[model samples]
Target: MRRQDRRVHTYLLTLFFEVLISYIFNQLFYCETSKAALTSMPYQCQELILYGSVFADNLQDLERRLTGLCDPGSTEFHEHDLSFSLRTGTDPDVTIRLRRRFNVDSFTSHQWQFRYIGGPEPDQKCPVIVRKVIDSIAYSHLMMDFVKTLGLRMDYEYIAKGTVWTNGRMKVVISQIQRTEKAGHYDQSNLKRFADSYLVEISACLPDSAEYSATAKQLRDFADQLLPLVEMEKVDYWRK
Candidate 1:
């Protein structure tokens, strides 16, 4: 009887330790998996943009003012923009813009950019137009093929020659728009001016936790300085 009792006690102790070890291992595994999932999750960003145009004749003046208001030494680029859309009846459901920069007169290497811009929600009280924006750097040469494989059709394309200026988090882009003679083909010689005015866009992209109102106020204050010269205001991109 004594031997049986001793054996029972030893067995109980062994079982308790085994159960505790298993529980500890399972908890460590769960924690690591949770951390991995959190790290892999994609972060969403938002863009606050104010749009306005400067007449061809007033572009020089606008540039001069931008030089004073923005940071010194602007960056210039010649880029081709291609818009791809996926439509499942009615209006297109998904639209993506791919911008490829050609190192023209600059020593920088060529690069491709992919941008997904969501339509701005109609908010009457919001100071600046806010839209969800996802930007990624694409390095693959087969990017166009990959996009086509996904059944997205090219909607429109254009050429943009612009200078970019930055003041802290805010960015100012003044670009001349041009259209290619043939769709999907960007031949420099065949490109023609799309409009007589330069497109002036002042924008800032922020994370989800950013204070959009404060950023919009800063943009408004800077835009106010360029008043009369170029009126930058919230634009309803979908409005006819």
Candidate 2:
């Protein structure tokens, strides 16, 4: 059998190399952000971020697509998550602010926590709170319903800071929206179309297939339900 000291060194080296390769490949083999959509979404926008990837394009079109899911005919695209700024004491939190198109009740503001923080339970999903804003519409824009998918994937093989750490680089789909004469927005040519996918991509890194299956379901459901709204039109959706 191999000596005990050599065995320990070999094991450590294997782990270190695994993690290093993961980071290098992630940086070098990233997706190209050139997807286009002819149809314009309501409100002028840009992708500041998508999911957890480095994508920071297609904000206007992405917002347009997101709001089209629930109340298709309304001018307000509500109940979605887009990158926005927040502040706790002095720390500026650049977060995806979940907004409701209109409020029904007098008090509907709610709470949310950053999911990327290295806490006790990084795998445990955070609780989505209620975001209520009063308006003619009855739906409360709390708890963003779905996520948009633009067919691009970010691949990685290792964790950034070992097992106790995570990453934030993303594959983004940048797009722009323009209003049409038909009372909505449509891409005249390459209006705006996108596909974004992101993950840590660790082999044998999970609880089980059952857990993985559940997570996959959630992601697919979100993508299927939200992306088509890219053709919507509402000047107010992109604004504060």
Candidate 3:
């Protein structure tokens, strides 16, 4: 009887450990997949990391720095999104600084931006066409490495459009930014702000009744539904 009891105890212990291992593996896998889903963008960078090793830390910061739609750079200018620039390595030796993430809160007023490498243009309003957008922005900055990196998606379009308010009326227009192809010998490029967006300013032209209110609602709805993945990083990893 003593021998049988010891045997059962050993078996139970082994089973418990096996179950615990299984649970741990499952949790790890779940966390990984969740992280990937949260990032929502491609994991590979010129095939450097195959969407593996994407973790809750550092990864979130990367996501915000890479794709965060809240344009914080433009104070004299307001911003809606960011672009990346790439530098390629061909010789036997080279080093490049890839954008990891930005301090969202710390960035406060000071702005940082990334641009496209080179390629096509983003389809109007189809923000998901990130390949083209990133490519365009990178090329504007003459970045080569960014062109090699694939699987980019821009799901949001936040523009601080210009608006004029006159006679209790408002008119909205697409905002324009001042930028040049000049590389930095001194400082970075400029990212202008859309202090005024069309929807926000357009209602000024309408009568001061609910008619303009509907247009305002339309703009707000468009902002919420039409644009996705604009700001997913709720926490800034660098701070943590």
Candidate 4:
């Protein structure tokens, strides 16, 4: 009887451990799957962009007007952008842009912006530009290496010094485009401006369910306010 009792106890112990191990493995697998599902869901984005320029002489006036029109506590930024292109040869090239800031006054100094912009919609009748845009914020710099490993080649790089402001969902940026005298060099002192005017762009990203008419009207009204100083209108980039 003693030997039989010992055997029963050993079997129970083995069964209990097996159950415990299975439970632990299932929990780990579930957690990992949930994380993957969340990350795989892409952000639904839409935007309206209008570009124009402010002459050096009228820049201060434009800035003052923007201050009064937009929300207070605007941010000034200096950024470097690298454009990478993935060529499949069979289809159109896919471009991804990576932007990082330098001499930033805000807490987002270490963040890298990974941006993917889809081609403009075929329907030109839409007042606002509708396209697929993914803007991912990554803290680690390993993203550059990961992109390169995907067979994307660096196409070009540039610098933008700008001030950003927000009014509700609308974001306004006035920047000066600059280029390095030597390729791949990002020094501020060595940068040369593309032109004497400041490039003004007003844009916003919205979710899939956003009403297009209301958004377009709002953009049009706000853009009208910046008139004479800068004319903001939809541009056909591929027309050239």
Q: Report the Cα lDDT for residue 132, model 2.
A: 14
Question: For residues 1-240, could you state the per-residue lDDT of candidate 2 as single tens digits?
Answer: 447765565455434333322343223222321231111111111111112221324444544553443233322221212233322222222123222322223224432221111001222232111111111111213223321121112211111110111112112122222222332122244222232422111111222122343433333344444445332111122223
RMSD of 3: 22.1
The 10-residue segment with the lowest total lDDT in model 4: 35-44
Point out the higher-scoring one by TM-score: 2 or 4. Answer: 4
Q: Write the per-residue lDDT of candidate 4 for residues 82-130, one digit (tens) a residue.
A: 8886543322245577888855235244356666665565656666566
TM-score of each: 0.74, 0.19, 0.18, 0.73
As a TM-score, model 3 comes out at: 0.18
lDDT tens digits, residue span 1-240, model 3? 477775666455434433422343234334435533322111111100000122233433433432333323212233434332221221111111123223223333321233322221223332211121111011122222322443223322332322222212222222333222332211233333322212211112222122233443443433342123232111211111
Give the 10-residue window scoring lowest on summed lDDT in candidate 1.
34-43
Give every collision pair in model 1: none
Candidate 3: residue 68 Cα off by (Å): 29
Model 3 alpha-carbon miss at residue 214, Å:
8.1
Local distance difference test values of all predictions, in order: 0.71, 0.25, 0.27, 0.68
lDDT of 4: 0.68
How high is the lDDT of residue 11 in model 2? 51
